[model samples]
Target: MNGNRFGRLFQVTTYGESHGEAMGVTVSGCPAGLELSEEDIQGDLDRRKPGQSMITTSRGEPDEVTINSGVQDGYTTGTPIGMVIQNKDARSGKYEPYVTAPRPSHGDFTYSAKFGTRNWGGGGRSSARETVNWVAAGAIAKKILATQDIEVKAHVNQIGDIEAPEVTWEEILEHSEENEVRCAHPETAEEMRDRIDEYQKEGDSIGGSIYFEARGVPRGLGAPRFDSFSARLGQAMMSVPAATSFEFGLGKEARQWTGKDRNEDWEFDENGDPTPVGNKHGGIQGGITTGQPIYGEVTLHAPTSIPKKQTTVDWETGEEKEIQVVGRHDPVLPPRGVPVVESMLQLTILDYMLLAGRINPDRLDGQVGEYQTDYHPRSPDNMKE
Candidate 1:
C-alpha cells in the first residue's frame, strides 16, 4: 500500500499485484517532447516477460504495456505518464491453502504481522512481477539518456557458478540476447542453462549474479560526501525481492587485495584523457563518478515456490501440517532479471544526468561542455592514458 514509489525528480508509483486485475504506474516529472508510446515501453516489456525459456516462470504474460496518458502524437506532454498491463493468466484457486497458513521466505507472515492482512496469492505485492512498472518507467528514462550518448547495459554474469568469460561491455551486449540466459558467452550460458534445468528437474532452484555497466555519461553525475552514486544504485537493487547478494567493482574480491592493489591509479594521455589502471572501488570514489564506467552486480536467490510439498504449521490451529505453494513460478530468475536490472540503471543514471544537466536535449548552452555540470574532478596530474 505504501513505499511503492521510486526516484526524485522523475518519480514513479507502481500499483497492483501478482494476481491483481491490472498492474500499472504513474510516472511524474519527466520532460515534454520526448518520443514515447506503448510500443516504446513494450520492447523492454517483452524482454522481461515471463514464460520465455525453460529457466523462467511458466506464466505466459505478453507483459504488453499500454500507455494511458502523458503522450500525444508519440511525444510526451510533460504530464504524468500512466501505463497498465492487464492480467490475463491469474489462477487464484491455487491459493486456498495460504488463506490461513503462510509460505516460508515470503511476505505472508510479515504482512499479517504489520498490516493485519496480506495477499498470499503468488506473493501478492512481494512478487517480482512488481518490476513491470520499473521497465515501463525506465523505458522513458532510457529514451531520454540516449540523447546524451549515455548507454546502460546488464547481463547474467554468473549462474549457479557458471561464470561468463571476461569481456568488454560491447561484447557483453552482443552476447546478452544471443543466449536464453542473457550471458555474453555462449559456452557459459549453455552451462548455466544446463545447471538450471538440472535443478528444475529436482523441483528446486538456485541463485546467480548479474552485472551492469553505464557508459558515455559525462563526469560529475553523483553527489559527494553522503549521497554517493554507488549508494543510490545499492538502494535501487536492494528493492528487488529475490535479490539476496550484491557487489560492484571487484566486490568482495577487494578484501583479498592490499591498498596498493586496490587503488585505481590514473594515467595521463596526450589529449588529457584520464585512463584508469585499476577498478578497485567498483566505479565511484568518495561518492562521485570518476568518469569511468560504473560497474555493479546483483545476486538473486532462487524462486521460493517449488512443486515439491513442504511441511509447515497452520496459522489458525498452530498445528503442524504440509503445504505447497502452487503458484506459477520461475525455476530460476536470471534470464528475466536481466532486463529488469538494465531498466533500473536507466532510471538511476537518468536522475544523475538530470542533476548534472546532461539530459537536456536542447543543449541550450549550444555545446556539451559549456554547462556547469560539465566540470568533472579531472586534473592534468590525475589524467590517465
Candidate 2:
C-alpha cells in the first residue's frame, strides 16, 4: 500500500493481507544487537492474539512471530530486521455471505471501489489481524529505545458505558493484565466484562476507549507544522484497522475548556527542567516531547460481522436483504487493542528518536558483534498520489 511505509527514521513498511499467506514487516534503520528473541515479540503478540477472552472472537491462533534476519548470536547487527506472522485462523467459508453484499462500516465497499475486487474473507487487510505486524515491530522498537529510558504503556479506559476510575501508574500496571478487559481500574474491568457478556448474548459487539502513556521520553520528538509529532502520531494511530477516533492528552475534553483552563501551568523541577502542573499538552508541546508522560486515547468501533442479522444491499441484484454475519469476531476489541496502540506509539517514538540522533550510529552500545545480518525490501513504494 502507498501509505504503508512510516517514519523519518527507523522506518517500518508493513505488508500482506489479513488472510493472505502471511503478514509481515520490513524494518529499515533499526539499531542491531539489542537482545533479540521470539519471546520479546511473542509476549506482545500473545496479548494481541484472538481467543484470549470470553468477550473476544473464538478463533484460536497464537499469532506467533518468526524473525528471519538482521540478528546473530543473540544481538542486533545494526541492520534491517524482517519478521513474519502466519495467519492460521482464517475461515474463508464464513465470508461467503458477504461476497455480494458489503458489510457496513467496513472496508469491503471501499476496497472494491478502489480495486474493483476485495478480499471478503476475514476482512482482508482491514482486519485487526494486520496489527500483529504492528505489535511485532513495536517489540523491536522497544529494544531500540532501551537507552533513552522511555516506556510506553496502554490500557482500556472504557467499554460501552463502563468507565474506569482515574488510575495511578502502579495500579495500571498491576491490574491492566489482571483481566480480559485490560481496564486499569479493578471495578471497572469487572463491569466492562459484564457489559461485554451482556452484548455477546445479544449477538452483538461493543466498542470502548484505550488510553496510553509514554514516560521519560526526552524533549523534542515530533516536528512542527507539516511534520508536527502530534500530527504524525495521530496519523499513525488512525492507520490501525477499526480505529474510530484518537485524541491526544485531554483530547476532546480540551475543547470544553477556555484558553485560561486549557493552558497547563508551568513548574520548575529540582533538575531545572520545565514541568507542567497538568498534562494539558499530553507531554507534547510545539510538536515535541515536553519531558512529561506522553498520553492519548484511541476509540474503536465494535467489530462488524456480528452473528445477529443486519440490513445490507446486494451489489449485483440491487435488492436489500437481511444478513447475519457468521465468523469469529472480538465482541470487545479495545482491551485487546491496548498492545496495538502501544505498538504504534513505540514505532513512532523510535523512528523520531533515530532522526533526532538519540539512536544514531544506528547501534545500541554492546549490541554489535561479528554476526551477519540480512536486509530485504518488502516491495517497491507505490508512489500513488
TM-score of every model versus the real structure: 0.91, 0.92
Best by TM-score: 2
Model 1, residue 251: what's the lDDT? Answer: 84
| 177-292 per-residue lDDT for model 2 (tens digits) | 99888988988888888899999999888988898988878887777887888988999889877788989888999879999989878889899876888888898899888878
Question: Residue-wise lDDT of candidate 1 within 136-233, one digit each (tens)?
Answer: 88888888888778888888989887888787887887888998889888888889989999998988888888888888766677886557787888
In angstroms, how far off is 215's CA in candidate 2? 0.4
* lDDT (CA) per prediction: 0.80, 0.82
Q: lDDT of candidate 2 vs native?
A: 0.82
Q: Who wins the lDDT comparison? A: 2
What's model 1's TM-score?
0.91
